[model samples]
Target: MASNSYCESCSEEGKPIAAIRFCSDCEERLCKEKNRNDNINESEKLESAVYEEVKNWKNHIIKQINTVVEKLEIDLSNCKKKNLDQVRKDNAKISELYDSVKEKEQELKFLKEHGSNNQLYLKLRKQRKGIKDVVKRVSEMTMSYKRTLLKFEKKAEIDLNSMGSIFEVKEACDIQYKPVKLQQAQVQLVRVESLLTLKKVKTNQLNLSDRLCLSDIAVTADNTLCLCNYDYGVCEIYVYRTYLDDLTYSSTLHLPSEPYGISILTGTDKAVVTLPHKSYVQFINTEHLKLDKTIRVGEGWYGITTTGDYIVVSNTKEIRILKKMGEILGTLQ
Candidate 1:
């Protein structure tokens, strides 16, 4: 085993070796063989076995992978179908809402185009006026008809009285019969109901010749009329005794610049009057017709009215509400 030289065929000690493997041509282990032989058949068998085992392993893995992929694909398809169905339902709901909105819009347009409450009120007012006019005309015609019937009845009564006074007289006889003298025809129309007939009185008996030029008359809840007169820079407030009925010119008290617009305080004898040039509303007592208080209004005051506690006045382009003592509370356009 420790020799430097060794046999080539058997690996003997102290011998020269010639061949390390069998020669291909001689089918023997040799370094100098000249013949050749093929060993491809044996290598092909080993390769075929290795390839078959690898093929079997690859087929098994492929079958398992295909099964997993099919399951995933089915899940994906179901998710897509659910999403599509949800989208379809949403679209249907949107379409229905759009149709409902369109219907409401059409109804509103029809009402705006053809029907207006203001126009309806105007039409109703016109119809009411027509009905009132017809009623008044019929009343007048009925009164005339009743008057005509009364006149006919009176003429018939006069004719009956004249017939009772008439008697046939002989035209020619030895003793002549006296002829009655014909009296003048007299007639009177007697009313069927004395109380229902209206009595006509002559208004000339009052002899009302003095012209009353009263403005800004303040009346109480009981219809007592009062006003101020501005003559020659003097102011005098007057109260009519007999309800200003073409017979009275008396007054209780008076105050200054002849206040312009007057309004009765609700449920009281107090009143508010606007002095436009002075830009103030003055509260006056209806019983005494004297100034009780004065309150400043806005600029360019023109008209006035009272709502119980507050006095309302129309300024230039707005309405102003104030307390009774002339404090500005609110303004409205």
Candidate 2:
């Protein structure tokens, strides 16, 4: 004998139909008609829910995009205003220099043409020297201003590209859910102690003819230390193998200029050393212990660092960004 299961939804009806199938998700036995109606209703509910969620998400994204765009607009506007203000100030300075030079020229002409005293002639010579100095300073200032303008343009271009990427990402945003498999994290435990013991292992002395005036040092992956000796009489780079206990002198290479700062290039067997007074950085091959090439940076290159395909050197007044071959990209004051 087969026992019939009545539909859960319409069981109280006079003529309750027999349940033909069981829904695992709903945990109910339903008749054909009732099951069909429930499925249609469930699909409609799911569709409505999905539509509402997507609408909310879209609105949220729109709000975020608007906020970011507004911020970018404000930042760009501020930058423009600041650059314009600087340009105005520079122009005023240029005008002032022009006027001063013109006045000095008029004064010199008058003194040279009409004055007869030796003192007046000496004064004219001094005025001419002062005018030359002013002109040189003006030329330097103009170059600096041009560099600043170029930097601003580059920055603006980068910002615009970033904004475009953001918009592209927003447009490509699609709602998707995926099942992710998670693995247990592996953690290692290390022993900790309250007091640490320290002991002196070994010490080795460096024997050199010249005075020890070490300016910069760089260590290789193989425990080889390269030291720059900035002594005027003996400008040399010394390489030493750092053993477990002591250092052994490996090799020494002489440099033409005094090395001020040194930095190892990433993923390379080379180091860049800056010569402050000489206005150049020498690229030395650490493995071969020889000078590879030299790049003229600028005067007073005290600090140096390498990033990607560029080398950044710091002079006293400004930081100059250069390519590996010594092409000056930009300057930061």
Candidate 3:
């Protein structure tokens, strides 16, 4: 809490007095006075306005649904008209064929009873031909006729709660807070002096079997440096002691795939490294100077770092933030 010179509790004396130290009750009284900043007089008006807005939204959605329903009804009416017309035409053709058959039957009976051999033969043949034509017409009509079926396809559904959201508006300076300024001494808690410049101290190189492309390096708790190198299509890690003035080679790790980057997680020995073009990360047991185990995090791993409870990995395209147990948290492009 910041100090105040004016006494808030003793202001009834008609003169101002400097407050040396405030008690708990005085602080509480001041806080209660400050808490009275809320003006609840317009709450009923706000409630009415919000209720009107909700009603408007509901009406708008219902109107859209009704419009769609009306359109569907019109289409259904047109479909019924078309289907009835086709059915009526089919019925008319069948009735005409029936009437013609009845007339032919009478002609066949009259010719059989009164006609000579030539007339009987010609009439019978013509009647058979007409019957065959009628049969063909009926068969064709039945085969060519199609039955149409209509279905109510629900392509979407309305979720009223998911349509929008309601939230409290917190404008600027709505919350009372005391801004604390850090002292200059507190600012430098991690470092006594700042780094000004760099100077060459010592330089040495470790020879490997193939070409070296130093991808990433990390310092372990053992005061050693583990360098991840992509060595001529092979993954290799070279360990070296950094406490000595001269670089001392410690050991080399051979991997089946090429390595991308390395990061330390409480090391002098143990570390983590990502494999290039691989979907997993290998844990380096620097104590045993060997790979402990591997966890499948993501694909196209390029660079990686351990921050608090998360392991952030990055490729050329995007970054994958993951938990320690290979759970994918999120991604950034």
Best-fitting candidate, scored by TM-score: 3
Off by over 4 Å in 3: 1-38, 146-165, 174-295, 298-321, 324-333
- How does each model score on lDDT? 0.57, 0.74, 0.72
Instruction: Report the error of model 3 at residue 205, Å.
Output: 39
State the lDDT of candidate 2 residue by residue for 1-333, as single tens digits. Answer: 122366666776665777655544455555779757866997799778777876787788779879977987888888789888988988898898889888877876787788877857788778877877897987899678664442323345323222222111224312122222110111122334567788877767888755879877888867889888887767788889997877999988888887878888877888899888786788988888888998876667878888778899887788889988878899999
Candidate 2 lDDT at 55 equals: 78
Report backbone clashes per prediction.
9, 0, 7
lDDT of 1 by residue, 31-55 (tens): 3221111235545775787678767
Query: Which pairs of residues collide in model 1?
Result: 8-17, 22-29, 23-28, 25-35, 25-36, 237-254, 238-251, 239-251, 295-326
lDDT for 260 in candidate 2 is 75
Which of the predicted structures, 1 or 2, would earn the higher lDDT when compared with the native? 2
- Enumerate residue pairs that collide in model 3: 220-267, 220-268, 221-267, 221-268, 222-268, 269-286, 270-286
Looking at model 3, report the run of 10 residues with the lowest lDDT sum.
182-191
**What RMSD does each model have against the real structure?**
62.4, 20.3, 12.8
Q: How accurate is candidate 1 locally (lDDT)?
A: 0.57
